[model samples]
Target: MARIGITGHSNLTAASAPLVREALVTQLSLHHDRLIGVTCLARGADQIFARAVLDVGGSFEVVLPAADYRDRKVKPDNAAAFDELIGKASQVRTMPFEESNRDAYMAASEHVLSSVDAMLAVWDGRPSGGRGGTGDVVQAARERGIPVTVVWPEGAERE
Candidate 1:
């Protein structure tokens, strides 16, 4: 079985979404029936990864940053998808923070890194814009000697 984690940008352009999703599906398919995806279940890359994992017959686990993440961080536009993905997760873990913040997000990403064999980063090769952004997660995974695959398809662009 292959257990993979995901970290990615939340502001991918609409035209790039399909390209990223296709790439994720292709990568997840390699693990086939024994695939297990680990993610924070955030809006962009995480949600896309979760869907791809399920599409490839894999079960995914969620690592929530904080107790109030769903209410505070998950915007209304993305709430339905988040709820559906949460419902489909094989396991859901929340960090010990009452509020969602950068520290909590980093901690949750660390938690995901600790259990996964590999990490998939849907990034654009840019530096992180904030404390717990995609670059930080990818860097943390690399520092921990976890294999990371950057899945920025040819035409993938950030918003």
Candidate 2:
């Protein structure tokens, strides 16, 4: 079993989000019952990934950049979902932070990436907002010799 890391746009849904989620879950399920840890922050891809981890009967973990549950005040929906995931997770780690400095981002990423045997990155073809370049995180995992899987949605042709 491999521990997979998940990430994607926090606001995407329907056409985009579900497709990416499908691709990720498909690949992760291949790990069979050995699938152990699934790590995620708290946001769009994070929420979707959490649900998928539960559906697959795999272990899930959340590593937050905030101190504790207090960050909820800034993200009611995300906070609620994060809390819900916490209940479902086999393990949860909180690294007090505000998502403002590089230190926090690195710490959060470190926990999420290090916990698992591999990383699953959901890509929508662009840089994410304030969460640092997810591409960088994926690459970092590679540098650590962790396997990385990607879920990319086929964008509709432009008019």
Candidate 3:
């Protein structure tokens, strides 16, 4: 079994990745019994991936970047459901980084990557804001030799 991680745009107004993630969940289940761990950032791709992982029988893990979930602010109506999912995760890891530094991103990302066998990138096909862009993360996944599947919305550029 091989774990699969996901990367994509955060703070999005349009959503096509959710459907893609649900499909991936089905694909993963049909192909492998691998554990599914996702960063519970509650942004673009994180929420959908976590839900899909939960939908299947695969183990779910949340690699948070802090000791408290307070830093994770969620506006979803199913806030309770989100909390419930994280609580049910097989493992929960946090780095407890106060400053937004490169080391923090690397440590958190490394933790996420360590448990994964492949990556599913749901990008907008554009330059994401900040250093923690999904594109950069996908590149890192490639560097780590993980197979990647990039899913973009309709009309979004493809490579």
Q: After superposition, how far is residue 57 of candidate 3 from its true place, in Å?
A: 1.7
All candidates: CA RMSD in angstroms?
0.8, 3.4, 3.6
In every candidate, how many clashes are there? 0, 5, 0
Mark the regions of model 2 whose C-alpha exceeds 4 Å error after superposition.
68-74, 96-100, 125-131, 155-159
For each candidate in turn, the TM-score is 0.97, 0.80, 0.77
Instruction: State how far residue 125 of model 3 sits from its true place (Å).
Output: 2.2
In model 2, where is the ten-residue run with the lowest total lDDT? Answer: 150-159
Residue ranges of candidate 1 with Cα displaced over 4 Å: none
Error of 3 at 31 (Å): 3.0
Q: lDDT tens string, model 1, 32-148?
A: 559999999998899999999988889999999999999999999999999999999999999999999999999999999999999999999999999999999999999999999
Candidate 3 per-residue lDDT over residues 1-159, each given as its tens digit: 767777766554444555566555765575455566667455557776777776776767777665544344455564776677777878877777765455565567777777787877777666646666777788788888988888664543322
Better of 2 and 3 by TM-score: 2
Model 3 misplaced regions, further than 4 Å: 14-18, 72-81, 99-103, 153-159
> Can you write out model 2's per-residue Cα lDDT over 52-92, one digit (the tens) per residue?
77667777777766664345433864666666777887777
- Total clashing pairs in model 2: 5
